[model samples]
Target: MYRIFIKPTLILAAIAFAASFALSHVNKITRGKIEERARQQKEDALKAVLPPYLGYTIVEKNRKATVEGIEFFYSIAQKNEGEKILKAYVFECENPGYSGIVRSIVAVDEKLTLLGMSVIQQAETPGLGARSKEMASNKTFFEVFFGLSRKAASDKEAVSQSWFEAQFTGLDAGKKIGIIKKGEWSAENAALRQELIDHNAVSAITGATITTKAVILSIEKGIAALKHVLEQENNAPGEAASP
Candidate 1:
């Protein structure tokens, strides 16, 4: 009886130990490649956000950046001019969607002007918001935020907050960025609205308005957070001595 029980127990132990060894080996082999790929991917995303005319370099990682008074993690990318900056990409913000988090990489120039933004990940419903990735050239609803220009630093909220949040379009950094009923919008707003509508406005995936809102809010909050950091630095008076 003892011999019979001992044989089965030893077999089970052997199997468990083998499984653990295999898992550890896999992790050790893949860890470095996984980290390298992630870093390269982030660099590619940052390049997408910056204006075509400028160059960029990574400034920091895993730090907070804000938009529209909201905060999120950022990987700052900057363009150099001998020793100065010509453009910058502040943060790549991610927000929860209906199925998973949607990620966006936002870029601003040295003058603190918005350059462009691109979706990194989204699991929105198919045929609706899932089409955001295709909106830029296909006239879909989601492309409105792309190529959004900023005339000044303060204008970041103007473009990201109002129109994009409510799914409005043609908004610049100087616009009010608000929402109204279909007919209540002003002539200018009405014109912008129709343009978006014509663009197909990347229609919400029927039951996924919450996910859409999350994407917009993430961008807004990210911009707001970075703005706060820049403000703090500007007020510090002596922190500029070093990079």
Candidate 2:
């Protein structure tokens, strides 16, 4: 009787082991496809912000190894048939939203202008900060940075940096982009501030100032990160355009 029961138990154990091995193999086989699908989804979001007539390529094919401390993927979008690098970028960033982290990517043209940006991932209050992602209306929030450049052309101010990073739009690369201190800013900066106010200048979500600032600083840091990268690129040898 004992022998008869033991044999049946052993057979059941062998079958269970076989099933586990098969599932493991299937997981390995499909992993590549799964990863590819995720990558395509991200690519679609980034491309939406870029101009339709422009062309671009991935400077770094993989996002994980490109930048440190930032958990999202990034790529440089270049526009030109060839040889001309129109834009240099690092994509995807995380900021605190009304409810949670809001993630996005910042793009700068070869001339160091903020070309466009997109929110790739975010979890904010359903109607407030979440609105930051709306393509139709929320777009103005991002467009505020277009053609924006640093205020001080000299390394002194460029390197000084700001906790609440200045938002200066329509700025050429070699200009002093200023900001308003509630009332002290010049007409130009005040206009910029008003535009941001009209479009939501990193406004705190109704009652969620912490969450709102998180998103604001995230964009700020995103700009800072790109600035740092561009500065390095400008100093790199063999990258100078021939006259």
Candidate 3:
């Protein structure tokens, strides 16, 4: 009885060991492939999000700040001919939304004016929080007047809801951004308009107030983190601000 039981247990153990070994081997092989694909996709994403221009070279850099374990990836846009500076950047910030962290990247000129930005990563609720990436309006923000002149009312509608991240273009990072619900069509409230006009305000996503706030907070943090670099570049005695 002892001999029979011992042999059966040994056989079972050997089979289990062999199965685990096979799985580990498969995992290692697949992991390498997955990593390679991820790297390629990241490179593509970084390239796509940059300010669109021809003959500019991107120089990538990663930096970790002492505060809040913030890590950012940045790129310098350099001209091809004389290697002149086209645009400068101070890149990413991770801010917590209702569901999880929202990671964003910014592109700025020498004056630290926000030029372009991309939401590179996010982990949030599907319909509500995720709408941060969408435009406030899928159609024209405000429609064009008489098929000729463009008015602010119609222009507002043109902004992409799916690309809500692009709304930050041309914002001055010096001022704090307040989140508001008012848009071009609705202006009954004077105080909100005053607040928006007085302060650099961003219109929040409908039903996604938390996500909108998260985005604003992330940008604020990003600006804070980039303060030193911006000051050094913009305040240099002999430096001329980029147009």
Candidate 4:
């Protein structure tokens, strides 16, 4: 009875313990690398959303605050002349999308004009909602087939900005940014794109109005939090308002 039941049970328990220990050791070894990669990804997203102008230094404050009972994180970008010139405030926000959460980084200037926005994380539908992060390729199929594409030599440079996210740039963050179903935006249609920009609106992704509205809601909530924090900081005793 000892060899048939008790001994086998003890051996299986030992094996399970050994496997758990090995997994724990492996996790300890790779934990730092995982965290570092996440940090780097976040830093890259911050840089992507800021204005394209040169000489601005990004400082990741990672400050935490709450507005309307929701927590938010923000950072600042500055230009160093003789002194620090406040360039833009970058805020990270997320909202529930059609399939999952869609997170984005948004940059706005002192006057609340949106500098840019980048969708960093999402698990939305593939063809429709996930297109929010899709980059527009500068070269067409025919251009590539003829080998006449300017970026043919470097495929990595062939893609331009994410059309969905790029539409938020230069819009007013202080006011309600609108959304219209004009069509998927394209650089080729410069005139129609300008019309949407003039209306302070972004063209909604085809068949993904829920995902589009989720991003807009996230931006609106983030801007409101930023305004609240800025107001608090400006009113603090002996502290000048942030430029």
Candidate 5:
């Protein structure tokens, strides 16, 4: 009895250790590539939202703050028309959602007009809350926000680029943004939807009210946190240095 039970337990322990070691080794090997891909994806998302600019500078790295356990990041876009004027300000934040944390980024012009928004990470229910992702054309929410470009010239084309995310553009951080679900949305009636758009209201995904609010809250919190930074930088423009 001892031989039979003890032998199997030892074998299982050895197998578990071997598997753990192998997984750890593989993770170490691929860590660099994974980080590179993530960095590239974020760079792409930042560029997708900001207006045409010569370049960008990261003013602050991503870090969690004590206030409400929120993590935030910030950047500044640059234009080359003449002196390198600060084109726009970009920021990111993570907030809790139905399934897990939802990460997002928002851009705004120097005058405080929203440029665009993109969902960086989420773990919500698939086909519902997960629809918040900002994927390439033909694979994201409504295809209005698809395609990876700085700007779309035509109104129709611009509307399609991350339609939901794009709606956040032209909005101001000072306003109290609201949510509108599809059950009440009149997609067929352009006028009704336009009204919602005009009022800083986000059109919610059917059956995903919680996730929609998560996005809204994340944006709001990001704006609040970023405002502190923006105010400080503006008040002390010479002290701040770009990353």
Candidate 6:
């Protein structure tokens, strides 16, 4: 009985230990690559969301602050021209979505005007909530299906800006932004897109209102935290307030 039972138990234990060790080794080997990919994704998101200027510098890199017990990370970008300097603040925000957390990078100016937003991470359902990160392709279905436009597409530089994210550009971040259930946005429909922008609203992804709201709510909370931090900084002794 000891040989049959105890020996099998020991064998199983050894297998489990070996598996765990192998997994640890694999993780160690790939950890740096994973981190590097994540960093690149964040850097791309920051560039996509930041307000356009002739050229800009990252004045503050990965600054951290806590407001009301919630920690926030942000970066400041500056563009200087002659005697004037323009600045933009980019904040990373995450909120629970239908399937998982939706993380985004949002940029705003000194007057609380939203410059842009880019969804950096999300696990929402495909063809629905996942469309939040989908870009409106300029190619027609036939061109894509037949690979007729491959050369043209490859020649042109790819842009990460998505229709859902583009709606947030030039919005009033200090106030509530609205969402409407008017079909998905199309890049070719300039009139309809402009109409949505004029109303300070974004067209919600079909059948994914929860994910849409999650992104908006995250941005709002992040802006609030940033406002608190800025206010504190401005009030600090000998600190010049942001203009």
lDDT values for all models: 0.56, 0.51, 0.64, 0.83, 0.69, 0.86
Instruction: For residue 131, give model 5's deviation from the true position in Å.
Output: 1.1
Model 6: lDDT equals: 0.86
Which scores greater on lDDT, model 3 or model 5? 5
Tens-digit per-residue lDDT, 1-243, candidate 6: 989999999999999999999999999999999999998988788778874452767899889998999899988888877898977788899999999999999988888888889999999999999999877766777987898887656533466778889888888889888898887776678887888778877888889999999999999899999999999888887686544
Off by over 4 Å in 4: 1-37, 52-54, 80-86, 145-160, 240-243
**Cα TM-score per model:** 0.54, 0.48, 0.60, 0.79, 0.70, 0.88
Displacement of residue 215 (Cα, Å) in model 1 is 1.3
Candidate 2 per-residue C-alpha lDDT over 1-243 given as tens digits, one digit per residue, 9 for 90 to 100: 758998889888899999999999999999999899878757655554454445666566434423356444456756564675565564556776666677765555656454455565667666555644432211233344563433323423322211122332222222222322342222345664566544434223344455446644665666556666656667878677744
Candidate maximizing TM-score: 6
List model 1 lDDT by residue over 1-243, tens digit each: 768998889999999999999999999999999999887766655555653456666667667644455556666666667886654646667788777888877665544445656666788778556755432222233444464433333543233222232342222322222322232222345575676445434233244566556665666666566667777867786887755
lDDT of 3 by residue, 100-130 (tens): 7888777666566666566667877887777
Candidate 3 lowest-lDDT run of ten? 135-144
Model 4, 227: alpha-carbon shift in Å? 0.7
Model 5: how far residue 173 lies from native, Å: 2.4
Any runs in candidate 1 off by more than 4 Å, and if so which? 1-9, 55-87, 110-113, 121-194, 197-208, 239-243
As a whole number from 0 to 100, the lDDT of residue 39 in candidate 5 is 94
How many clashes does each candidate structure show, in the order listed?
18, 1, 17, 0, 7, 0
Q: Number of clashing pairs, model 2?
A: 1
Candidate 4 to truth, TM:
0.79
- Per-residue lDDT of 124-238 in model 5, one digit per residue for the tens? 9997787665322433344546655334335334433455566676676668888776443323556756777688787776677888898889878877887776666667857
